[model samples]
Target: MTAAPNTTKPSGQDSPSTDTAVLRALRRIRVPQTQRNRELFLLIFAFLVNGSAIALVQLGTMGAIDAAFLFYCGALIVLVLAMHIVLRLFARDADPFVLPIATILTGLGIAMIYRIDIAVELGGWDAYSTKQLAWAAIAIVGAIAIVILLRNYRVLFRYTYIFGLAGIVLLILPIIPGLGTDANADVWVSLGFFSFQPGELAKISLAIFFAGYLVRTRESLTAVGTRFLGMTWPRARELGPLLVIWLISLGIIVLQRDLGTGLLIFGMFVAMLYVATGKTSWVIIGVVLAAAGAFLASRVLPYVGGRFSNWLDAFNPEVIDRAGGSYQLVQGIFGLAQGGLVGTGLGQGRPYITPLSQSDYILASLGEELGLIGVFAILCLYMVFTSRGIRIGLAGQDDFGKLLATGLSFTIALQVFIMVGGVTRIIPLTGLTTPFLAAGGSSLVANWLIVALLLRISDAVRSRPRVVIG
Candidate 1:
């Protein structure tokens, strides 16, 4: 015979004489593995596309596959996979599309750069493609570290003023003697053995500063504006920040001779301001200020005037024959025309015909080889990327995170527009390089940092604690 055991019911909740306690289950916005697994699948596709691009380039140009380029592709994939692994381990809730999109775009860049190298008969470690791969490795590693280390993106708000000051210093680094390079644009900073455009990093720092600053001051900026032109305009006191940023931008155009970056920084600030305040007047003010600045810059800066001339009259023989001519722009246009609706098929078309084709004009290179369809596809990818970033910002719970993500997203969108618009003659060509599709180490590293920060913010957004509801 077995003895029956008596058990007492738990007492805190559902007891007749005691106060009932509320019970809640811990909940997550998503299963962490779901996001990570989606990311992995897309990464595999990106790898295949990148590898296929290299294969096509080699076969089209060299009549056979090059083992060296294959090795380069392998190296690049390893770096990309390394970032994926870091995200899986540290940021499982991160957005799935961002890493894969960045991987494919940058991988395509390498493949195109290699095509140009082969066309130009350049090889070995000195090849620009090889150097670009090296930069990609550095950039990917930097991104991985950022993802792993930056568990919380909000800590950045504590140092808002510091970032703002640092952005100014970075913007001015090129003007400092012994550090500045005498390029057409004084945006490069050299350290004997290494040189990079400080403006690239400046954009990131400024975005952070702007996000934090706006979060702290949005109320004052939005509350006390005058009604005018069917829009509420900020008071004179509020205009101080706008005026300061505008002056800084003009200084970039005039002192640093970097009209593209100047416009980029100002545009980033303005976009962020609009996001924070939700006011149309800020955008109107920003455009008027930008337009006024551009008009003034065109008159005072020879470089600005030259870019306008080259842009408007690229086909003119006189403009083509000038010291700083539209010859490059015209060639880029011809290359795109030759590409037509469908590209000339990778290496078959002569992307190397345009100077700096792998850098400032890489879009033209890709457009020529891949055709109008290919460029449209690339533009669509940009749309997807920016949309993802904006979505991430909108999903955040905190103002700083939202503004920072939006600012960073807008920075990428604006840079692409500036660079691609210039390349297409939709706007005057500025010194801005195409985001991931161009060969600039500074741009690569800085852009990857933005990606990492976005991933961090997105993961945080998803992982914020919630009460499970039946």
Candidate 2:
């Protein structure tokens, strides 16, 4: 007080008070500790519980609780460590809840597969459950690597067409001799040690392409065009590309007997169109187009006609006689019946008896074991996830981000609806997999990649500075 000399420090000198304020601000902005950690721990717990339940069921089947217990414990430890290490890399920006949700779905799928394996083993047949477990491990590692490596979403926009071409190529690859196997006309490629389905990748790559393309053309598409029926119709010239794509996709369905994948791709296109135009009229047009296409296909394509016929008479005993068509639907319906309300418990239901139990009919198996409640829970999870995606789309800073989010979100929404509708008999059966829950390498990998992109866009939204307008 006598002099208080030099109390005002040099401008370059750090003020302890200022430093404390900055640090406090940073702490406030840091990731929420409770939310993030809680989600992670819950997923880890889910993984353990799922594995243990699988082992218990397997042991109950084989009367070898000790061995199954040991194996289950080991597998759980491996999966958790693998997932943790993977998430540590690229998923840092992902929603705190995304990984946890994925974890539960993935873990549950594995458990169901393991349960099937035990049942098959008891019948003296080779069990693929162990193989499925191996694939799950691979998928987790792949997801982590993709998230870490693909740190930028903008790159996708740049290479959307290229990726789309690659996806189309992959889809057509199964037609190659010695490379593709025909399964009811839908080509399945054998990758020597493992077989891969290209349809999954096609869905994602095409979505990227659609997002980039639609974002660029949306304004034009919605702008001046021949006004008809109180709507701004896109010029025939402007609509040509979409028609070509629709035809190509339709051709694929008719030619390859891959109705489910074709329907999914078409649905993606229609949804993108609706988003771009924001026109209810376009939806009506789309439905009309879809109906027309379906009718034409049924009139021309044998498989399509047969499927439509089978769908029309689902309850007829004669319809269920067809191995390539209605049998799965009939069985799936019966399985759901078996799982009326609360389910038969995780390992108790007869899910494995259904053909294609791990693919399109996985939902049926899920319903059989987990019951209607479980199905509802899963649908709710998808709904929540979709809602978050929509929020991200709306909050995105650019057209590309918004379209990307919307397209990706709608892809999932439509796929879930189609598959769930198929399983519940609300609609004719479409052989589409449940996104994260289905057991397929390509589907699993592609879906996780989608999650990664969504997370990146979401982070961009979250990290954006608040804008104050005068």
lDDT of each: 0.90, 0.73
Model 2 pairs whose backbones collide: none
Candidate 2 C-alpha lDDT tens digits along 157-234: 998788779768877877777887756666578878778888887887888888888877787778677778887776
Model 2 scores a TM of 0.86
Q: For residues 6-111, could you state the per-residue lDDT of candidate 1 as single tens digits?
A: 6667665466433222232222434676688898999999999999999999899878988877886798788888888888788878999999999999999999
- Compute each candidate's TM-score over C-alphas: 0.93, 0.86
Looking at model 2, residue 329 earns an lDDT score of 82
- Give the Cα error of residue 414 in candidate 1, in Å: 0.5
What lDDT, from 0 to 1, does candidate 1 have? Answer: 0.90
